[model samples]
Target: MSDGERRDMGSKLSFGRGRPGRTAVTLPDCDVPLAEMPSPSLLRDDLPLPEMSQPEIVRYFTNLACLNYSVDTGFYPLGSCSMKYNPKLHEDLARLSGFAQVHPLQPIETVQGALALMHELQGFLAEITGMHAVSLAPAAGAHGELTSILTVRAYLEHRGESRHKVLVPDSAHGTNLATVSTAGFQCLPIASDARGNTDLAALAEALDEDVAALMLTLPNTLGLFDQNIVQIAQMVHETGAQLYCDGANLNALLGQVKIGDLGFDVVQMNLHKTFSTPHGGGGPGAGPVAVKAHLAPFLPSPFVGQAANGAYVFEEPEHSIGKVGAFHGNFGIMVRAYAYIRSLGAPGLREVSENAVLNANYLLACLREAYDLPYERRCLHEVVFSGSRQRAKGVHTSDVAKRLIDYGFHPPTVYFPLIVDEALMIEPTETESKETLDAFCEAMLVIAREAEEEPELLRSAPHDAPLRRLDEAAAARHPVLRWQREDQA
Candidate 1:
């Protein structure tokens, strides 16, 4: 069967004819008198809902699932997102009844085991990041960023300082500016040098007494580790300002260098990215913040700790930033992260980083000839290539990405960090094998050649996807979030 035919078969929005009195299931007769219906004014009329039998509904969703791309299905070099394939063993562990069934609101005494796991995980994270404290609250990476900024604010206020600005590098995660503003601080942008490192001269000019903290991404969004990080930390500290590490790129430095050791006062690690978790579709993340001894008091509340007698307990710091999550944040995600850590001890964790770096460099070497490497240096865990070479031929980064879908792979992120012209950020995580990497390189090379020989193919690409190219701007500006019946529309 043709791909178009399959897509057409799956694209039928209506599953069953909505004839009057037609029912998908036969409900049993009421055992007793039926309750009185609500008044007409209080009830919704002409409700629009799909009517399908259980089997039909299952088939519809099953077909829809086949249309979507996933980490399990293919290579996902989604740059800073760290779209690594999650290990199934972690999923199995998270599903265990003891871990899965425990209520977040259970009494502390009744949930000692869960608390113990969290406490131990906290310790592991502290050891990993070289921080004196850790908080398992904050639901996602952005939440963690906000939590870290707030912690910095609380610490500054407690110390009788009134710093109103937080410095963020141009190459920091896209969320840093928003997080800084959300925490009620002015976001001061630090420039990136020609080599993609933070421009030290610009940073020095920006640092002052009114600056509360410098929010930085280690191995930053460009995937280049700042060689002057220690010096940068020293410079920020000299001005009585703190260094806040955005651990979004922590995957590149696992067991290699701890952020706290680099003189950072606060750090937030994305458990969903560095540790193993099913992180896509905007859900189920744990971004635990680690702080130095001086800032430990201002961490998010209710972190697990060991008591004097060695029993596990939930301890809130004296000067906490308050609760960032309901209960220890996304316990299921924590379970998966814990499992990933335990399965891979310190050395194994180090090897994960090593292989991740190796894979990224390997792919970088393969495609640099075909694409433009703006930095022209070693990348830690991901490589950003400019599509300007192809753009001259009327092919942009988005065009290259869409063409990748036709070659049976998910596209890398495009036009990100807002620095590079026609940027294509690709991060092939440690989980991918050499064979898979080679296949992706081959596909990329083919697409690059096609971009020159047949530019129109790149322009109107992804002809193989279930849907054709969409008006992305309109889709975002005026999204149709829900299904609307033709009559209703």
Candidate 2:
């Protein structure tokens, strides 16, 4: 029950079911009749599961889970990645017996409730983005980008075009460009201008019939919404290139602006980011892609549906792209997102975005004097602060981040967007209170001072963490994983 007795300091893992030096279980070496092992090659071969009492098993995992630092536990301001708090109510709603107990392959009429939820979710996403149709497939954000781009390929192919290039801004997330290049297209770089938004001139030069699409992360990596989005969209559209909106920043402009109205031919929503789902350590996430009616046929198959008699069904589109996942797109995550949508409705969702923007801007105000604002514009849900000042003090952004952990704060993503020098991207989501913000700011200022006073301390920080800076070579070369139950063997 207490922290001292629970966590194992040296191992960096908690005392759990098979904890190295814990009296977790007492299974006899000799098997009883029911526990007798089957042959290894047999289809019904027994698993090497431990034998433990109910309370022990429960306590074991309970202690282990606590060792994890979740958004539920504390502040996780890993910017560009909205590590916002996922409400437990969403989990409860998702696990309602009617929903949780159902099998995916159940007949349409039987699971109408689920189908209806999915339909409404699709509708909600479409409404949010101003798109015609949405496909609740594509497991994660990168997956969604791949899905939308593939649809673009299919669309262009239908028009007898064989475009091979995707115009990606220099400041775009690595995943965006990676998805493009991986999808068998040349990734053409469009540089960012002085203000850090996509350089329109570079984009104009990149425009050609050979370019399949231009991908834009709305409220892009710099955390500043592109100023010339309309003009940029039109320019891309002019060259007969499809415009893809990486809706990772949908958290910022949910009800305020629609991507469909903003001229995006395809847009994907990170339901986990916008709708409050835990990033299951890098996710079993939902990135539903919304597109105009013209691209509907190319969507992934087995999308949820609603029958005329208020029944829920799963159906494949006539011109489908086959299956993306086994059943539905991370339906549980989708359920959480849907629940979040229903909980917030329209007005509350808008406030979620409004307050998110307000929070980021407030933090921006707090730090602009102390740090260099990469792009001094009204940011969306996050703001990118350049650690140019700290770098001048012989400390990089990485040092600043390492120092933050010692102050009991998780670091923002560093050296990202690959545009700004020593970028420290921060997203203080709407959930944080002003007091917490003030405390975080105070820590930042203290660190800023430390950067000047004892640069070495900042350079070699996170001394308070369970482990200090790891030897990357040693760690990468030899990663420890899992526990061995010597007693069981």
Candidate 3:
């Protein structure tokens, strides 16, 4: 079939073309006596199984894979996601037999090398974040947030304190609020100032002994760093509350600053985000939680420790939160992150942040005239622009995002950080070259111009894509998750 025809029938199953005797697999004859099958009621004869040959099945899935966009295929300027390209070297290292083949249940003495790697990774993360202890137990970025909150609760309870509120900034990620509530604390939202920093007056008004912690997303969701972070930390500490840093934006501060030194009591790093691991697609992620000395005792269990005999071993904290997962976090993701840190070293890591900041500012400078700047300041690793200018021509931020697909680029995040009217948050990671940045900027500008001249085109966009604009709301509210033949449907 032609490509267009294939695309049109992409959603259909592979059930119809199979001949009566065709099969993808051929099983050998049973060598022993057959076991009795289950009762008749337990089996369903109506279920249809696809019977395409092996090659046909492979070709069908391969064609589907080609339709998907990936960071490997193009520039992904996804803000706050740090969806940069992962190094192939790391992939190779993680797949080595010594690392990949070992079972998690192996005796500690038998897997000393893997334990040593984890031990060194813990120390490396501690040194990078300037924290007293690090626990590579949380499975993902949001998992790290939940872990840190639980640790804070444990520490507070140990002190016989019953702080029941967690202050979350209006600019924080949705997971921050959810983490707070999930940890059994009420989430109190703090507003952002006009300059895009946390509103100090509002935070001061909200601070009290009852506040357990203040969860701040450093550089926040707007992709703008809070200049008042130092003062903000002090305020939280004064109210007898811990300060939690959601270090998802740590890409903007790799070697520039350490959250521990910034007075944060605890911080969670998304190794998958900042450390160059593959992200998204419902990750196998690593979000290690780091803490100061006071909160160290409450860290999650099974952190790597070194004995005086120079052997690596697993040890639990004095006031542990127990195992957060079946094993010590995602081992494969940890390997990738460890490789990322060691390969980059200190200076290369610093350069990562510098280039990330420069690329973001470059895009900001090039496109500010075409779009609305929500916060007029130097952004760190990403820039959040308003699509209000395009909206004035009846093209919303989502429309602008859809138009970018036709320009052969994945759209940056839109209508997020909620504070901006028509938020277009863009993060051009350090990996992209100037040529790529310039191309993206040009496409964005072209889209802006088209918004004015051909608003309808933006409204019904992605004309070049295999599928046009979908009913996103309908898809969300009433999803069709399973597939069936038309007659059954």
Candidate 4:
């Protein structure tokens, strides 16, 4: 049978299979007294709940799980996101009863062990980034960015300065721009020079007494380390403005260099990305912010502090920016990250960066001939390539990404950074083996060949997947969030 016929048969098997009056669970009688029922006006009896036997429900969900892609299932080379493989050991450790089952509101004396873990994690992060203090309160990367910006704002305000503008590189992450505005500051975009570094001339012009901070993403979205970072830091400080480093790309410099040593006043590290915690799926992630001594007073509140008696306690900074989260940020994620650091130590962390850089450059060397290399410099942890050549043959980067699905590999990030035309950004993180990289590269080369010889194949791709290419634009603009039975439809 054809692929379409098979898909139709599968869909038929999936839907409308629930038998009436069937139940998956048998609930025991309630032991507690029941509350009064609400009025009928507040009730709904026509909910489309599925009814199926326990075995059938298990099989259905198992099939659904098999259809999803994850870091554990295959190679994920998503560029800026750093989709690295998470160690199951860390997951098992995080699930321990003491760590997983503790309440955030428990008495401080009872949870000293958990508090000590956070205290030590803070110190480890500070040492890793060479910062004076760290706060484990921000929940995600963007939250960290917002927290850092707010801290800068508070610091400047405390000094009786009213700086209103924050300088952001043109190739910086979208969150940087949004964070600046959300912190009640104007975001000014700085142009990148021909060599893909921040334009020194434009930065000089942009800096003045009104500029609050220069947010720099080291080894920026282009994956090229800025050769003039020290000079840029000097320029920003000359105007009495602070220098903020977006440490999302710290995976490329872990154990090799510290952001604080590079003259940044503040930096935020994504524990989920670089420190090997569970990432994606709108998840429980951590983005702890670290700062130099001068700005440490404004870090988010309730950071772990060590008393002179050697007891761990939550202490607010003198001039803190106030609480950025409901509680000490995602405690489970923090535990996993703590386990990752203690397991790796200093030497292993350095190897992480070394192998990450090596794997990325290997892919760059193998694919440069087939794809367009926008910049001809050595990349740090990720490589950004342009698909303008394929676009010339009437095949776009999104088309190439869709075709990758046919080869059983997740697609790299495409058309991002908003600087390169038809961009295909790939990052083969340290966890991937050379053999996996080779197989992915081979599939890409074959797709490149098919793009030229048979452009139509690229235009309509992923023939083997369970679902064909969807109208993503329409789906985004008009989302169907609820499911309904065929009779209701």
| Number of the top lDDT candidate | 4
* Cα TM-score per model: 0.96, 0.89, 0.96, 0.95
User: Backbone clashes per model, in order?
Assistant: 0, 1, 0, 0
TM-score of 3: 0.96
Error of 3 at 96 (Å): 1.0
362-444: candidate 2 lDDT, tens digit per residue = 98989888898877687889988889988998998988898888787888888886888898888888888898788888888
What lDDT is obtained when candidate 3 is compared to the true structure?
Answer: 0.91
lDDT of 4 by residue, 260-341 (tens): 9899999999999999999989888899999999999999998899889998889999999999989899999999999999
Q: Name the lDDT value of residue 469 in candidate 4.
A: 88
Candidate 4: which stretches are off by over 4 Å? 1-15, 26-43, 485-489
lDDT of 1 at 439: 100
Q: Which tens-of-lDDT digit does each residue in 1-489 have in candidate 3?
A: 565855565555667756666778899999999877778688787867767787878887787777778899999999899998999999999999999999999988999989989999999999989999999999999999999999999999999999999999898899998898899999999999999999999999999999999999988898888889999989999989999999999999999999899999999999888999998899988899999999999999998999999988899999998989888889999899899999999999999999999999999999999999978898999999998878878899999999999999999998888888989899999999999999999999999999989999999998887778989999999999987677989
Ranking by lDDT: 4, 3, 1, 2
In model 1, what lDDT does residue 240 have? 98
Candidate 3 at 475: error in angstroms? Answer: 1.4
Where model 1 places Cα greater than 4 Å from the true spot, the runs are 9-11, 15-22, 38-43
Q: How good is model 2 by TM-score?
A: 0.89
Candidate-wise lDDT, in order: 0.90, 0.84, 0.91, 0.93
